[model samples]
Target: MSGQNAVREFTAQMSVREGRWRLYVALLNTTEQWPEHRFGHSVPTFMDRTDALSVLGFAPVPGAEWEWTEDSETPDDPASPVVLIAAIRVCSWSGVSV
Candidate 1:
């Protein structure tokens, strides 16, 4: 696979520290292969850092922002089953972090 394609297959995982948030991106590969699969991406944003931390079972840290990507694969037909590639977390105060 090309380097760009490899990066796309990777997911970003984020965690919060005392007053800062850390991000970790990882590559993921699937054993199963399917044709004509649809892919999608999304980010989770929170207004308050506390709220974001709460869901992560961590205490609210300073300069915390809520952000994450929701990536998945869906079938073209409504009745078709859906597949989730991976959940990517993008932590940033203003916009999504790479």
Candidate 2:
């Protein structure tokens, strides 16, 4: 197995605390070998797409190469089981294609 992966579909929520914005990573897609994995991380909001990659164990990919296919304000946090978000697309750190 190699030291990289990809996320075919990525979904995340937004959060704010102490006057700072952050990404509240919630859901993640997984490869055929595994089920979709849920994640939680309070990462500072970054205009760079690849910022959350390494933190999730991904090797490396250009942050700019990633294009946001979906993004919308989410209010389900306080109402449901949600928290900070930091997600990746097309891959998982376990060498699985998401």
Candidate 3:
């Protein structure tokens, strides 16, 4: 695929806000593929990151994880660790076989 038909790149990130973990996804370069979602608008937030990933049709690769030190609100607090998935794959449209 090339140009308009090409699959765009997307990056996912997670951060803690108000004691709750939130998942964020970079907007797709082309909205033509996902007309249901609007451009330059706020996306909805899900309490569970797994749920958000499901709705977005993405899954993390097995054994790929990393610590997000930038999101550590209290670096001095050893009790709180910011571990996040480092790699992910776009699942099939049917939401099966990642």
RMSD of each: 14.4, 8.3, 8.8
Off by over 4 Å in 1: 1-8, 28-98
Tell me the spans in candidate 3 whose CA falls farther than 4 Å from its real position. 28-48, 61-67, 71-98
**Which structure among the candidates has the greatest lDDT?**
3
> lDDT tens string, model 2, 8-40?
334333344444444333343533332322224
lDDT of 2 at 12: 39
Instruction: Give the top-scoring candidate (TM-score).
Output: 3
Give per-candidate clash totals: 1, 14, 0
TM-scores across all candidates? 0.24, 0.30, 0.41
User: What is the Cα-based lDDT of residue 19 in candidate 3?
Assistant: 49
lDDT of 3 by residue, 1-98 (tens): 24534443445566445444555554455342431211122433332444666566654444544334443445678777654333233332332321
